[model samples]
Target: MCGRFALFTPIPQLTNKVGAVMSERDIGPRYNVAPGTWIASIRQASEDSAPTLEEMWWGFRPSWAKGKGTQPINARVETVATNNFFKSAFAKHRCLVLADGWYEWIKNTSPKQPHYLCRQDREPLYFAAIYAKREDGRLGCAILTEPARGSSIDVHDRMPLILNDDSLESWLAPDLTDKETIRNLVGHIDADLIEHWPVSTAVNKPSEGQGDELINPL
Candidate 1:
């Protein structure tokens, strides 16, 4: 699961990559982004609107289910389509969770090792996500995760569902809500393009460090 990640890439580069416009709030770069906090995302508000950069609370709990269920941070891709709590958003509110890389732990180690995984080319990475407005009116989201692939399997049994560059626009298109059609048109970034390396354990405490040094090779 994508419990912690980073999104220090400049907003201009993020917008240019996704053909989106900037949002009103200023989101200063942060190297240690934790759940329950607002994070950047790219989404289309409606069929007539272009995609825009916006901030969404990392945890998801639909307004309708308020006070009834858990606010999940990660939604498994295999069941998100059929899950009662997530299916509505999965069908109409898909978005991209922007990041430079994410952190995962090797649970077998004495002090579980943290690894930073990102595209080999260091380009912007976008994780597939679905969002819903909370009772307070703020948008919240959950990153989609799938069985680990490639080098990611070395660190954890699951990883975020990253969308390939070619699939970005199609994934956000408001009109293409059919689950089967979406699965066919939107594909993940090749697992082979993902690379990871052991990083400083500082990432284990999301509140302890906010520097790039946390991602430095150990």
Candidate 2:
């Protein structure tokens, strides 16, 4: 699960790369972004709408599920399309979550060892996501995750469903709602492009980090 991550890239540069119009200009670089917070994403208001940079609450609870117990931060890709909780959003509210990298902890270690994973070239990673209006009518999102593949499995059993750059526009294409079609059209980024390293355990406490040192090699 992608519980913690970072997005320190400047908003202008991110928007330019995403081809999205800047809608929320005041978002600053965040070096230790946590769950249950407002995070930035590129999404279209409608099928024909141009993508726009907007903020969405990181936790997801569909408006219909108000008063229900769960607000999950990550949705498993295997079930998202068929699960009632996420299917509607999966088909209509798909989005791309921008980030420089993400944090994961090695499983079963005496003292959990946190690692920072990012593209080898340091280019931004775009996570496949879906959003929905919550009980309070606020927009919230959940990152999609798949069984860990490549070296990422060494750290955790699951990782965010990151998309290849070529599939970005197709993933967000509102007209392509058929589950089979979506599955066929989108593909993940090359796992070889992802690299990870041990990082200072200061990241163990979410509130205690928001600086470059949090991600630096231990």
Candidate 3:
């Protein structure tokens, strides 16, 4: 599950990369984004308009949930399309959750080392996500996760569904609603494209510190 992530790329750079207009609200760099926090996401302004950046709460709560329970931060790709809690959003509210990198822990080892993972080229990463509008008129989103593939499995058994450049158009196309086609578009990024290294445990304390030093190689 993608419990924590970082998006320190300057706002201009990120908006340019995704062909989105930056929102009026200034969302400065975040080096330790946690669940329930407002995070950056890209979605269509309308069915026929260009994509735009928006900030959404990280946990998902469907309208039917009635604010009664915990909202999930991650949804399994294998079951997302069929699960009642996520199916409706998965089919119609797909979104792109922006990030520069994410953190995962190697649980099999002592002390569970935390590793920062990102594209070797340092380009921004986009995770497949689905959003829902609650009765209160608030937006919430959840990242999609799949069983680990390639080198990422060495650190954890699950990883976010990172989209490649070629798939972005289809994934974000507002008019596309075929479930089978959407499912087919879900693809795994080759693990070799990413690089990782152990980082300071300071990242574990989100309230205390969150800066470049958190991702620095230890």
Candidate 4:
């Protein structure tokens, strides 16, 4: 699962690429974007219009969930259609979470190695996500996870749903709410389009003193 990622793109560049209409809010650069934090996303409010950019809190906890707090950072693609917490959002509140890169742990014989996977051409990665509104008025989003294929399997079993320019409309269109369509859209698994390398574990302690030195080759 993609628990950590980076999103430090310039506001203008992001708006230009995705054509997202962003609010006046600016959160600045973030190297380690953890769950329970707000992240940028392009979401379509209805099935008839173009997508709009919005800031979404990166977790979901259905109000019916009997607890003080039960946050969700991801929604299993297989079960999202039927799960109460994600079903409604799956049908209509789809979104694309923007990221420059994402991190995954590769457990080899030596130790757990963390690989920072980014686009080979250094382009941005757009992840398929679903979101809904909370009673408090904040938007909640969750990343969709699917089994990895080919080279990515060597590192992790599952990867976030990635959408390129061509696949953006199908994933974001609220009208195409068919389960099989979503399954077929699992994409060709473009792991080769990604660049990966090992990094120091300093990223583990997010609050301490992690900085650019953390992404350096270990």
Per-candidate Cα lDDT values, in order, are 0.91, 0.88, 0.86, 0.76
Q: Per-residue alpha-carbon lDDT of model 3 for 128-218, expressed as tens digits?
A: 9999997678889999998877667878889999998777767878777788997687565777898889998877778967778889999
C-alpha TM-scores of all predictions? 0.97, 0.96, 0.94, 0.86
Question: Scored by Cα lDDT, where does model 4 land?
Answer: 0.76
What value does the lDDT take at residue 66 in candidate 2?
54
Provide the clashing-pair count of each candidate structure.
0, 0, 0, 0
Once model 4 is optimally superposed onto the true structure by TM-score, how far is the C-alpha of residue 32 displaced, in angstroms? 0.7
Please identify model 4 stretches exceeding 4 Å from their true place. Answer: 47-49, 64-69, 108-112, 182-189
Highest lDDT scorer: 1
Which is the winner by lDDT between candidate 1 and candidate 3? 1
Specify the highest-TM-score model's number.
1
Candidate 3 structure, TM-score to reference: 0.94
- The lDDT, on a scale of 0 to 1, for candidate 3 is 0.86
Off by over 4 Å in 2: none
Candidate 3 Cα misplacement greater than 4 A, ranges? 108-110
Please give the distance, in angstroms, between residue 136's alpha carbon in candidate 4 and its true position after superposition: 1.3
